[model samples]
Target: MSEFIVFDLEFTSWPGSLEQDWSAPGQLREIVQIGALRLNDDCSVVEEYEALVRPLANPRLSPYFTDLTGITQEDVDQRGRAPAEALGDFLGFCRGLPVLSYGNDMVVLGENVGWARARGDEVKNGFLSATFLNIRPWLNFIVPETADANVGRLWEVLNLPKPAAGREHSALFDCYSFTAALKHLHAMGHWLPTGFL
Candidate 1:
C-alpha cells in the first residue's frame, strides 16, 4: 500500500525584535523539532518518527520559544542532534514516501536544505525530489465555509475533535490534528488527489 508521511516542524524563535531573521543565512530559524506520522493507504497509522534538532548558530532557546512550544533549553541541549544529522535521519525514515504537511513546511525545508548545503553536508537529492502536498488549501476547498480559516481556526472549521488536553502546537500533535482532519474529509467522500491515495 502507498504511504503518506504526515509531518510537522517546530523551529527556534526569539520573543521580540531580536528573533532570527528569515533572510539571514546565519540567523534563519533552525528547525528544533520534527514530528511525523506514516499512514497506510487507508489512513491507518503505520509508524511514527520524532526528532529534536539542535540549533547550530543559535543554540539557546528563548523564554518565549519555551512558552510557545514547551520545549525547554535543557530538552534540546540534552536530546537534540545537529540539524544536518537530524534531517538525514528523518529523510531515511521517510523512505521516499509522499509528504503531507500544513502551512509552509516545504518552504522551511527548502531553507533547511540550503542551510545544510552551505555547511557541506551531503543531503540526498531524492529528499528534495519527494512530492509535497499542503493540505490547507485542499481543506479550504473541501470546506468552503472555512475558506478564510487559518491554522488557529482550522479545528473548528473542519469539525475535528479536539486533541488530547494540552496537545497542540508541538509537531506531533499538529500532525495528529491535521491527519484527523484529512480522515474526516476522506470519510465525507471528498476527492483527495490521487497522489494522496
Candidate 2:
C-alpha cells in the first residue's frame, strides 16, 4: 500500500475516569470524536477524516471532559452522529490500510462498536474486519524519553513546532501532531518500523 492510516479518538471521560478505568456507574468510553489521516511514504498527508459521535449510555458531556477537550455538549448534540454510523463511515475511509494509533485506542474503538452491536446496531466494515497496530511499543523503543508522552503532545515533546491550531485533547489536532512527529523522525534518520516510510 502506498498509504497508511494514523488515527486518534476522543472518548467520554470524567474526573478520575482514567485512574478509575471508567468503572463508575453509567460511564462508558463512548467515542466523541474520530480523527485520522492517510499518509504516503514521505509522511505527507494524502487525506484526512474526522467525525463527531454521540454517546448512547451517557449522552451528556461531563464538565471535566468539556474543560479538557474544548468539545462542549452543544457540539456533540448539534453535530455528532450515532456511534455505529460514525465509526462505520470512519472504517470505510480507512480503506483497509494498516491503521495505527499512538496507544490502544483500537480497544476503545472496539468496545464502543461492540456495545453498539450488542444493542442491535448493524455496523458494516466493523472493528473485527479492521487491522489495528499500536505504535507505542515501537516508538518507545526508538525514543525512550517519549514513552510517557501523550499522543497529542508528541511534537511538543520532541521540540518540534506546535501544530497550526487545535489543542492537546482534540482528536484531529492530535493526529496532526502525530504526523508532525513522523515527519521529524523521518528527517532525522531515526529508524521507524517498516512500511511507515
Q: Which candidate wins on TM-score?
A: 2
Provide the overall lDDT of each model, using Cα atoms, as 2-decimal numbers: 0.75, 0.87
Q: Tell me the tens digit of each residue's lDDT in model 1 across 1-197.
A: 67778888888776552333455444567789999889886677898788998888788886877888899999998999877788878877776788887677877777787888799987765465467878767777768876665443456667778743445668887777777777777788875676455
What TM-score quantifies how close candidate 2 is to the native fold?
0.94
Clashing pairs in 1: none
lDDT of 2 at 26: 86
lDDT of 2 by residue, 48-106 (tens): 89999999888999999999999999999999998889988998887557788999999
Lowest lDDT 10-residue stretch of candidate 2? 188-197
